[model samples]
Target: MKKQFNRMRQLASQTVGRAEKTEVLSDDLLQIERRMELVRLVSHNTHKRLVSCLQGQVGTDSEKRHKKLPLLALCQTMQDGGAQLGDESLIGKMMEVCGQAETTLASELMEHELQIERDILEPLYQLAEVDIPNILKQRKQLSKLVLDYDSARTRWYQATKSSNQAMAAKVDSLKDEMEEALNKVEICKDQLSADMYNFSSKDSDYASYYLTLLESQADYHRKSLAALETAIPNIQLQQGQMGGPTTPPPPITPLNSPARELTSTPPPQRNGSVYLTAGTPHSQGGSRGPSPHLMRRGRSSLHVPLKGDPRGRPRIRWEDDISKLALGRLGIPQDEVSSLLELFPSRPDS
Candidate 1:
């Protein structure tokens, strides 16, 4: 028993000592791992700082690529440590590009939704439904009203020989029809008011949607343009960009067509009156008139005033379309046109 007891005690001591030693070894191992991690982190930070400095110093594309290549390679080596070391710089750059693209796309989405509601759907809804059928029904009632009135009159005439009971019933029915027609008219008027309200509401909504769409488009364009301004270099304004003819073209005159004369035909006169002018009397006691050659239509044997017939002379004129046509061809301005009109001074006869 004593020997067994000693062996048990010794076994307990040996196990306890090994447990303490294991705990110590584990702690030492953890410390060595921590030192390794620190060394790795410091070396990587030093490399990063050196590359950043070199990139700052370098200007050539090849040198930049050389610096970038190692950075990309180092990311792969970051392994599980990436979560601890990687920052949000690249992520923020990516977000910046996405924001630019989304500005235009979001604008388009808003425009599309507005178009669907305002242009495509609302207009169709307005045109498709109506209270026209109710108006038609009212018209039908009005047509039947006339018949009811006539029938009631006939019934009353027939009832004069008998009792007036049936006649009174039909008369009452006719009155009911009249009241119904009035009621229908009132209903239609109320419906028209409602329709107007709906129409105005729809119109206002449609216009508002267009305004929103335009505003959104403007915002999108502003953002996109800002990005483009940053991305693209400014172009220098070149000289002589404004180009056109330095001098105006000369004005063109229009040609006139030949006029047809009716010299052989005598001038027909009605409402017996003569146009007179200052002239001498004829030797045969007949009246002499102003020279026909100076008057228009001389080719046609026309009436001549007795020379000094003593009434105010009527002014003669001719076609003046040629002058107007020339002015039109010249493309004259309003002020110049007024000046030309004054120069030409168109009369009622011409």
Candidate 2:
């Protein structure tokens, strides 16, 4: 009985020792699980703190990458330092470091983008509002100036037209007056020719007297021819000296001075009028008489009088008539006659 009791006691003691060993193993496992849980909690808290710091210090890119990380994986990484680490505390420190680095890089990139926008966009907007509007207003003002210039040019053209028309009207009026005066000159020339023809029909007793008158008339014509010849060189010399037209020579007087024997006879009466002799007595007792034959032939021969010589019969004033005709026909002002004559070629006397 003693031996059986000793065996059972030994078995019971062995069983009790095994159970206590199992309980101690179970307690160590629970303590280990609690330690792991604490490590995980501590790692998760550290990662969250790191992430929050990155969000505040850095910017969006880190937050976006962090959102992709699984909560369990992130926790495991935090507790173990990395996938290679079995230590929880080390893993937690590594995860916090990675989150902080990502935040810093994102913050630098955002700042760079902000600086680029400031450099490029701000000046462009200002140019659009201020410079572009000023350019448009300048173009509009130039258009208005062009329009005003065209209007002023049109007015200048109108004024020039009106002035030209007035000048033309005055010229036409001057032309009409000239034409009327020319007609009167022609009538005077015709009457002088008729009177000369009537005087040529007188008797032969007047032939000797008419012959002397012819000689005197021929002498006067010769003098006129000589004077005309002398005038040509004088005019050229004067024009060369003055570089312009010269003033016209004064008109010569045409009063006749007969010889002493021709002036002594009395005057005759014919056709109910007293006919003065070719040479007749002057009031100073100077003899002046023109013979009967002289009177008839002289009337026939004398075609025109000299200029400014009204003392002679009006029939002989052909040069005076020509000046009047030139004034009437050519529309030259009387004051400008000397200048107009300069344009004519010098003529030879017949």
Per-candidate clashes, comma-separated: 3, 23
Writing each residue's lDDT as its tens digit, candidate 1 over 6-70 gives: 33444454456631111112344344334434433543454344334332223234334433443
The Cα error of candidate 2 at residue 130, in Å, is 3.5
C-alpha lDDT of candidate 1 relative to the true structure: 0.40
Off by over 4 Å in 2: 1-95, 159-350
Give the per-residue lDDT of model 2 (tens digit) for 1-350: 64345334444544566311111123443443344344335434543443343223223354454443344244444434544553244433345545344333344434433332343223333333443344344434433333333333333434545557764555544444334433433443334333223323332422333254345445545654565466556545644454554566765533443454476564432221122233566789885655546554433342333334545455325435534654565443444543333322322333
Give the C-alpha miss distance for residue 225 in model 1, angstroms.
2.3
lDDT value, residue 106 of candidate 2: 40
RMSD of 1: 41.4
- Positional deviation of residue 302's Cα in model 1 after best superposition, in angstroms: 76
Model 1: CA > 4 A from native: 1-169, 197-209, 227-350
